[model samples]
Target: METVRTRPGAGRQGGSGRRLTRRQAVGALVAEAGGSPLRRTMGVGQLTLLSVGATLGTGIFVVLGQAVPQAGPAIVVSFVLAGVTALFSALSYAELAGMIPGSGSSYSYAYATMGELIAWVCGWCLILEYGVSVAAVAVGWGQYVNELLRLTVGVTLPDALSAPPGAGGTLNVPAALIVVLAMAVLLRGAKESAVANTVMVTVKIAALVMFCAVAFTAFRAGNFQPLFPLGTAGMSAGAASLFFSYIGFDAASTAGEEARNPQRDLPRAIILSLVLVTALYVLVAVAALGAMPWRQFAGTEATLSEVLVRSVGGGNLWPVLLSVGAVVATTSVVLTVQYGQIRILFAMSRDGLVPPLFSKVHPTTGVPRANTVIVSAFIAVLAALVPLGSLADATSIGTLFAFMLVNLAVVLLRHRNPDAPRSFRVPFSPVTPVLGMGFCVYMLFSLGADTWIAFAAWMAAGLAVYGLYGIRHSKLDHGAGPQEGA
Candidate 1:
């Protein structure tokens, strides 16, 4: 067991009973990484596929329709902006992931460099980012599932079973069902889920490539006439919406314990996945917009399918194939993101932050089965009852907050441990992280008032949980196995 010894005069607990310093936290993380049993079956290609699969889901299929109405053709600019912000954060993540090589993602980074309270807050924010994101994607997935059923089987799920409580129905059965199924795959093992993700990503990519090919055939230069109809503010708002699409590249970093050579491969995969996903997103956006007026995208639940039907003229197989692609895409997103969430919680639990049940990695499968079940149950409830719009807003805000903290952590680590080995470094140290933080803050404010309200409530709840339970139960306070007083 790894233990972090508390300081007498240097650090304060921040209400967690016993505080953890940067050096002590790093020691604990390193010890834990050494003792982990996760299988390192992923290479750069598999890791890249994981990031791409996690990223290329609802953002491309569902968000485009919502963003286009805000910025017209300038939604393309929004994609670039979101990509740039993600690039900065990805570079930061690469640097930290290379150094830490642990499973907690940004939450781990924060713990190692910032302290326990900051780490706890970072983990809580991630719950909003990943957990809520799965719910949102499941809700979006429900749309494609409904469309696929109607297109292929000539059947539509009734509103009572198809829509969420806030979306004119008692529950979204398909959304809830998909979450449950994903939980089953995750419970199997990391390598198993990864293999499944690879096949799904390949088919999903083929479908997008087909959509782009057919869309380009009907492309019209006239569609580019009014590029910025809603102006800069509208473009910024569109960027905020599009930002959610770029939130999953760091999902690659969450698998550090299961990586062959995390220090080198994790950084490479993070940057490579970002480049590939961005290129695909830009191509798809250009193709779709060139093929149809941006105004037509607004209020479209299944925009890509609509684009396929309109471009190729309906009564064909292409639209149905595209609908299937959307299902595969969003399903992959839920899978990868849910995987990231569980690993982060498992890391926290191992450190005696949350309940010990979350840290119980099954001996046979080398997976956190209990954590997966808990997360699945919680997300399924949200997917079945909550509105997608609310869940999405919370996700964007949470992800942006986590990204900002990650950028800050990178700078702090560099100053605190200049001798630490870093296979990859963020090119322009303070400048890059500073700019990344600025972008995150800008996007946070761009989110609606309701999102802010929801975020505040969630944080309040997290703080309460920490004070009432996490503080007294922390391993650092309990004198876990061995002591490392940094």
Candidate 2:
């Protein structure tokens, strides 16, 4: 085990006052863990399912209803465009994941290739990406749960307990409840959480498959008329909204430290998950558009349920069955995204970039229990009080910002260290990274004006935190040598 200054007992400023160069940060990351390493137990299949489970939820079930109105039947085109944009960035992430094999995701890559300050900012962006996303998914899960109850038991959650304050409700109790439940699951440990994730993933996939199967029975060629009714501008807008669906495919890379075979498996999991998710998304989009007029999909909360009722006859049992599936799908999304956020906190804390409490792994469970508790508490409050639309937009911008940094890292590393061993290299190097960066920038600007303003404010807060604490107290700032120089 690497003996480094990671505990609360270690002095804050005990080492020589010097910042870590990018090269030194990379060396320290690859050479040492701040304490005993995280357990290596996950194989490629488990890692791939984690990515799929995280990526598949919320966006498909919740955002599709909102997006369909933006592009009419051409929402199918929007899905394709967004998937392509995510693919470029996913490729860059795969290359970095194979080479770095660390837990910090894009933040760790930026630290190794850019510098500590930039990495701190990237880590902060992930806080918004993963943290806000969990809250957003939990809110969506609450909506589905209410819908399921209404469908199956002829009851609805009272508005006071169903919606956030911003949405005209006192508190979203169901949303908050699911977040706490997911936190409890994670506290049990990684393997246990992974097992839960796999089961939920199967349930979600079966749900989507059922939707496609029934929707196809009602396929009407006339439903696709005026394919581009809203024009290129609307299609582009829908693509931007739909991009949030792809957010968690990179969750696979966050498991690098725990993967039993990171070098070969990480890249495979990243690519495989993206491919599977994109295919599933396309199928779902086509089936929905084929089943009904796209204009009818706008602003509906229980979109898939409505479609199922209309297609299979409302008095039957299929709609209720599908509503149950929607509940499971959104819950799985909350579980997986919450899991990713804690691991990122674990990585950042181990490097002394955040509070050491975040790195406090449980002795028996081998999980970052303290980190999960802290993150879950904050997210639960957000889910209870915040509106879903704002949370979703904020998460999209944060993710796009991180994607830009990851692409830049791949470009910088290629030029700086051509000889570095990489298990997976991004094909067509400079072109791919440049295109990835360009796509991310385009989508970043495509977001709503309010989202940009909120993102700027979030960045300002992160910079303030970094200047006050992260910069001064970083283990890297203290020149902690590889292996602690003992």
**Every candidate's lDDT:** 0.83, 0.82
lDDT, candidate 1, 200-265, per-residue tens: 999899988998998999999789778888898888788777777787999998899988888889
lDDT minimum window of 10 residues, candidate 1? 9-18
**TM agreement with the true structure for every prediction:** 0.92, 0.91
Off by over 4 Å in 1: 1-23, 226-234, 298-302, 387-392, 481-486
Q: Which stretches of candidate 2 lie over 4 Å from their true place?
A: 1-24, 33-36, 225-234, 298-302, 387-392, 482-486
What lDDT would candidate 1 get against the real structure?
Answer: 0.83
lDDT of 2 by residue, 281-375 (tens): 98988888888778778767536767767665757377677767778888888888898898898888877778899988788888887889999
Prediction-by-prediction clash tally: 0, 0
TM-score of 2: 0.91
Residue 339 in model 2: shift from native, Å? 1.0
All-Cα superposition RMSD per candidate: 3.1, 4.1
